[model samples]
Target: MDTSKVSSLEELKDLDMDFINDIGWAKVMWDSLQACLKKSFLNWVDTVLTMSQNEDDVKEWRSTFMEQFEDRCYELVTDIRELHEQVLVNIEKYLNKTQVLCKMLQADMPVIGQHKLGLYQEQFQLKRQMRELEQMVEARTSEVNQLRSKQLELCKNLGREPILIKDHPLPSLNEISDLKKHIEQLEQETFDRLEKFTTVKGELIEIINLLGYTPSTQFELAVITGEESDFKITEENMESLDLFLYNMKKELNNVKEEIYQLRTKIEQLWNMLDVDFVEREEFRKKYVGDSLNTLEALRLELKRCESLKRANIKVFVDRLRQELVEIWKLCHCSESVRYEFRFFDSDTYTEDLLELHEVQLKKWKIYAEENKDIIALLNKHHTLWDKMIELEQNATGADRYNNRGGKLLKEEKERNLLSKQIPKIEANLLDLAERYQLRYGVPFLTFGNTIESYINNLHANRENAKKLKLSARKLQKEATAINPSTSHMTSKRILTDCPSTDPKKYKYTPRKVFTEPKKNPKQLQVPKILLTTLSKSKRLSVERKKRLDKIRRLSRQKETRDSSTYIEFQNDLSNRVDLRSTINVAVDNETVVKENFKSPARQRGTTPKSVGKKSPNLPNKLTAVKSQIKLIF
Candidate 1:
């Protein structure tokens, strides 16, 4: 119940006062006002009752307000209380009055004079306004009449006369003859002019086409009107036309030059074809028949040569194979030689042989056995040979050096010792030389080869130094070519507005989380060493290895025992053997022999001393029996 909803009443007190006053009135309107005021007051009372604090006040006031106002506040309500005493008297007095006039409605019974006079005055003013409006309309109508008359006069002056309809009549023959003659003259002149125009149009169209124009469409023709046809040939336009013609002529000359160039290019292409293809064709025709015969002969000759070469190669291969087989047998590693021999049976063996003989003959010509054991032996022999050569050269100067007393003798003794080793060195060098000569058909120390070998070997270090210099130069060049610009990463902090702290407000901002990629450690390949042999007692010593191993085992056992699923009873009783520590049991007869060398000598000579009688309960000593058995093997 809002107080603002009380649209009619000012206040609850005013509403009650109005109600009481209306009840106090004696006139007929008093009842109507009383009813309205009562309704309004009741509405006000209902609204005030809904207010929170004045519920009791609103209820009591609504219930007693009308009665209290009627009884105590207004005279009309007192009259209503006294009306029962006077109601019949007033009704009788009003019924006794008979003053009446015949009237259709009570309001139309007029008795006034000034009001009728005012109506008359109003009608007179309205008539005066109507008269003024009529005079203005008549003046406008007269103006319209005058304007129409002037328009008709203007029409006559401009010669827009009304057409006069007349009865039909035939044209005169003389007029028709004159018109026909005029038409004839017009047609002839038009034909002659059209012929000239057509010729001009054709010329202009040709020029336009030469300028890369097609014929005009309807819209284009309309835009460039037909009257422009005469303007195209005028003296003023002739200079422009001449310029266009000049451009066309220039273009024509340029096209001619292009044509000439194209013709030259074509001629050059033709000449190329004629020189290349025609000569080839002529040669083909001339040689095709003779070449066929020659080819047959050549083919036969090539076949013979191939057969000879194959036979020679086969012989060479057979000799090499035998030598290689012997070498393999000497090496006691025949598997490699057998693999190389298998190549000889293949179709590509000839290619392989050619490659090998061309490039690798020097490398493989030496027998593998000679190569393997000869290097160290040859080095020893070469040292002795060098010493001997030095000594011999010194001996030749020994006589001149006799100024020193015992120097000559000492040198001679040294020379003799070196000379004694010469036979052995010579024997080895000769054997190697012979083997090389037999395998490669080349002498050991040809003069040209020795000189070339000395030159190449002596210059190897120099060449390496030169190559290093070139590589350094190239690296410098690359370093100079590299760009000097370097890229750098920088960070910046920017300041901006931030929300102030308040209990009612919260603000959010993004936080950038930059995570670096985690780098994992690279895995390494563990080295695996395969141990071949060991003594039986070596196995026991390896268990006392690293101190950390015991700690690791104990920790692992503790972890297992602490697990929820582990059972104490389930522990394995046996010790697990480490296979890496297992001893490989093998008996080396050489080792055994070496170990028991004295034993063998003793067995062949004297027997061990023994007691006279042994205990019957004890078993006989088995050492001698085992030793005897081992010796027999």
Candidate 2:
């Protein structure tokens, strides 16, 4: 057979075994074996024989080699015996363990198949059993190794220690099961960690989104991307995630707070800018939610308002000041009261100062609203009181005598109305102020003084005026020796028209005496208007004789008026200038002016028929001066 022609080991072996029974093949094989033996031992021969003819040398080497071979063979047999014993021990132990597993498996699987299989020789059965056990061990070992690898991976992922068992030759059942249990536990832990990571990651992501932020780090990105296993799950890592979530929530809260404050700022700006209600309401409706986008929108709105405010700081400040003025008016605040605020006078158009003014205006507005009822009453009282004072002042005014078209009569009517309205309003004001003080634990103020205190001052001054008037009457009656019983009545009547004295403004001066100029007994003169109604004249019905006398006097006056024209025209016709205008002007200049020589008490003692009657000669003198002025012009 040609070895090169064989395609496989099985074919080669079959051919070699087929020639085993052939003598010719046996002769060739014997020759080859003899040559292979000679080749193997010839080198130990004395000279390494070149041919089989060297029998004597072969014999000498053969004797020495036989002895050495026997000695080496004995040593090899002894080592082999010991190795065989150790091998038997390992085999028996592995075999017993396998047999036990077989017995345990007997309940599930059975060997009740072919009779020939059971009829196998004892040694062959044991050998097959050992071989099968080896194969099973190999499979088990591979499985345990896989479990160990899985355990390591899981432990690493879980950020914990790995579990392992030593198996030198073959892994045992118990160790393999224990390792699987450890792997299972690690797997469970990994699952739990994954769950926790997923939960925390979701929370972190949700909070971050709510706060309108993005992931900035790889860990955060991993959480957001839902990569749970690649990351090591540990207490510290979870805590870090929790902390990250907490920080996001905190950021969201801060954003919400900022939004609230921004809305507040926008409201104040709206008031200062007088933003239309429609726009304000629309903006409020637009940015009503509490989401991050809402907060952002509100921030933008606030920024816009702030920009507008900065762009028109002066205009805004002026507008705010004007609002303050209106609010002050509502609150019944005094004009000088605005001086108490620095921003009210500040020229610096800064946001800080503007905010100050806004704050003040807001405060006053709240105050006005809170004290609405009281403010209304106070304003009403103030109006009536002012009118009353005005009418009273007009009582003694120099123009009091210029009443044309029933002007003085109208004033008296209004004065009487104010007198009626003022006390009622004042009473309401006082009641309201008392209630205010009771409710708020602070006094109602006017001109910086409490209402109660100011009212008391007025009352006290009125009482003092009454007492002073009574005293003045007693003194006058004692000096004049007037009827004592009637004097009190007359003084009380005089005092009824007198103004009450307030302690805040007190003054006193004596009345001036007016003595009539002595007139010629025989010369008829035009009757002078009495400074006061000196006495009542006797009344008598007009008779025919009196009527005729009055008509004769009127005719004489008519004749005189027909002869004399205007002073300047008469002078032109006569070609003679009169010097009387200059003399009259000098006389008027030398006369005592009421303000200089008279006092308020002088007018109080007089009871005139008409309140505003003028002197007769005074107008004629004024006309002469006017005519003189016309000639000069």
lDDT of 2 by residue, 1-633 (tens): 223222222232234645555678777877897897688666655354554547786676666666666555455656766777765666566557666545433312224223454322433455666667667666766786788788777776666777654545445566666777778787787788778778777777667666667788877776778556567786667777777778787887888888888888888788867899999989778876566778888888888988988988898888889888888767767667877775688898898877888789889888888988867776676666556545544443323323245555576678657656755665566567666766887766766656544544443343343333334435543543445335444444444544332212322232221122236666423344222211112212133225334533653354344223235533342331111221121221122122123324445764333334433322222233222111110
Candidate 1: where is the Cα deviation over 4 Å? 1-382, 396-406, 439-633
Q: In candidate 1, what are the lDDT values of residues 1-633, reduced to their tens digit?
A: 323323223322443434555454544566787898889887876677566456677557655665455434445445654664454444333222211111111112223233454433434443444444445444544544444454444334333432221112112335334544544544454455445545545655554544444434552352234554333232333444454445545655555455444434433333323336674455335433222243344344345444555545655555555655554444333364456545644444474684454333334445443455544444565566556444433432212212244444465567557645744554454455456556776634422232123223322332333233334435433542352121001000111132222212422231221112124345322222222332222222223223224433553354344222111111110111111100111111111222243345445765323223332322232312211100000
TM-score of each model, paired residue for residue: 0.13, 0.34
List per-prediction Cα lDDT, in the order shown. 0.39, 0.57
Clashing pairs in 1: 24-76, 24-77
